[model samples]
Target: MTIEVRVPTLGESVTEATVATWFKKPGDTVAVDEMLCELETDKVTVEVPAPAAGTLSDIVAAEGETVGVDALLANIAEGEGAAPAPKAEAPKQEAPAASGGGAGKSIDVMVPTLGESVTEATVATWFKSVGDSVEQDEMLCELETDKVSVEVPAPAAGVLAEIVAAEGATVDASAKLAVITSGGAAPKAAPEANAQAADGKAYTATTPGKDVEDAPSAKKAMAEAGISRDQVTGTGRDGRVMKEDVAKAVSSASAAPKASAPAAAPRAPSPAEDAAREERVKMTRLRQTIARRLKDAQNTAAILTTYNEVDMTEVMALRNTYKDQFEKKHGVRMGFMSFFTKACCHALKEVPEVNAEIDGTDIVYKNFVHMGVAAGTPQGLVVPVIRDADQMSFAEIEKAIAEKGRRARDGKLSMAEMQGGTFTISNGGVYGSLMSSPILNPPQSGILGMHKIQDRPMVINGEIKIRPMMYLALSYDHRIVDGKGAVTFLVRVKEALEDPRRLLMDL
Candidate 1:
């Protein structure tokens, strides 16, 4: 009756997750859709549910364990015609065992590197303290990176035994931040102690003013304890010390009564009670991810954006005339994205290089267009791809786009739905932006940015008059795609968008 559970796939590039919690314990009965445990991936937290009604028999994994996708998680005694359990690789308990962690044993937990190029983060604040009950997916602390404040969650539910890193400390990616145990020890004011050094310096092995003997070990211990030598109390002989001393110093300091977060900086936003009021809003998951990816993509890619303005006279007239009928027939309003998406698809089909990805040694050209439309939600920008845009009916495209967009705003889009796009289109014009030169999403050679429609003076039959003009920008990887290819691809998109009939006729 033992039904084995496994880690569901998280995202396209995600290979593993740190256990955040075991919501149900042994002998607990669970419903078919019940959340059995929580998982913290690099990007977000996800709940792993019980596939069927069952009695939880055992947790094959513990909190804080990093498990690969499809790894066995727990075993439940299925009720009534228990479906056959799916096969999984042997549980990764062996790896943790091999790495040397014993039951009830405590280990150092550190801040992980979020990306390849990111080096470190500043500890903005700690949410839990020593002896505090911690839960999986519960925010443990916040880290201020170069741009945003990121909420870091506890890998598993346990007693927070220590907070090694305090607010405002800039620590390396691998720096230790806190310690957890099955039950945290009560807060105790650490008594100062000194290690009699060979050089006769009384180095107090406690937080602040610690001496060191080996620089590497000191750095490593400091990295592991989330403390700098400047803040640790050294009591070694002649101010010379070791790693154990540093760890001891960190633990003692953490055991003390902690201070409350100081009132927000004078300049920090405060709530107002007047009309035209504003509220300080937290950056959402989508927004943070977007900001990180856009910045990272910019840093990694040699990007260049080409600009061109398109006359929307024909498309505008077509939409205005058929708008009511099209809505009545298709059950969706005619928006500018379909024309743009179709135009991008046409351009990509012609210049397959624009649809290609850069491998280390080769370029991968996609045969179909998985057009990514960046939907701007209250949470932020999320690009959900329209699978095989070339094959879908206009109504189908509208429905898919509508559904995906709704799900994105609702934070319901799965990791799979957000992935696998050959190219991206981010329309700044939706926010009524006059113009924008967007960046290329990594791996994709090109991205098309759309802007607002505005009336401007133009020449027509040797006379100046008002006309609706739209600015378009195409950002491309200059390394893989040449200037000519970029311009040609953009020109193709422009031509299709200008003459809406071309998109319908497959031109």
Candidate 2:
């Protein structure tokens, strides 16, 4: 019987993938659930497994060919066609004493599936070293992708035999990371360690016969501190050097200089001296992705910014009155974010174009508001989405914002939580940014920038008075959102915030 192989469903927003590699060729005997091919999409790598024990009969999609969901990839012929290959190898397996005596089965430790749009990852740390015994499902290493950190667990209980991809190396999804000999005992001492000890030389635990590379961040830190790698004892997996190690080394080095050397006379350094002191560090994967996407938005969109000011007297007064009660009731503090979120939702209803996106040759209007709240983390800036914000109450909005913000800072957000935003709100106010134009988050037509609120003199009712004022900037894609729509959106937000009663009345 012949069975057809088809592409599985890719994740949300992914439509197609390219055949990256074929593990099996035509007429190759394959077991059920054996990996037959790998597909690479813009976001993640997917492996296609064989449906049954069979012979691969044909390849309909060759490597490097693009295929959509449910497209034919190959075919399998079950039954007699796959029988002969195993019988031919029977003689070699018959010698059980030679093959099984104190030897265990070797299993490959592969990189786990990364989250959406993540193709590669850096080996962040290894929790186990070569010859270390581990249990099945024990975490062996952690891989840092552009989005999140993924922990790779052992596939079977074993002693790790080799490290194929060491710390500081970049590896693609499903690539071999290490080898584990299932059921194998850990050695008392490695042969190389004994030999090096006898020769009066120190040995570092790493892959045999290969030099372990130091992390790029560590290298840059070392250069700036004027310390060599030999001075720091690495605490990372397999004795890999890390940035934290360099920091400790620098701390120790600083104390020595203070104790042993006399204070130097102050003088301006020469250009040559300045040049020698500079250190270069490579950009991280998250930073690179942010740079690429920001540049792409600039290159593709007709971006423009509109500005307006808001009187915070009403919103601030309203919040101060009910904050204690609201926090007690909802178990979340009432903050400016909920007010801004509600204001934006109210504004989006009036200026729908600001909440819409441009597809190929068409404009897609979203009736529901999925607000993206831009947050800054130590790694980089990220936008986590709150679905259907138009229907959420002030308390709900505050709780959602607080939860997502906490997760974003800790790098625990999932891909689904970060996608599907209809409009964005970036609050530079927390960082004391007075007034700055914000950039539009791509696909979403508009982004609202909220700046710091300060007391300003304003003429209200023909009298000069001090009032809390904030500058609001609305950045939009001119291709889909007209200038008038952008201006109207900002005005609506200003009105809602200035008179909090307007929001409650749905005005």
The candidate that achieves the highest lDDT relative to the unseen native structure: 2
Give residue 399's lDDT in candidate 1 (0 to 100): 80
Per-residue lDDT for 73-144 in model 1, tens only? 999888544433322112212223332333432434557433433456766445554555667778777675
Report the lDDT of model 1 for residue 359. Answer: 91
lDDT (C-alpha, whole model) for all candidates: 0.69, 0.80
Question: After TM-score superposition, what is the CA distance of residue 292 in candidate 2 from its true location, in Å?
Answer: 1.1
* Backbone atom clashes (below 3 Å) for every candidate: 23, 1
Q: Provide the lowest-lDDT 10-residue window in model 1.
A: 86-95
The residue pairs found clashing in candidate 2 are 43-117
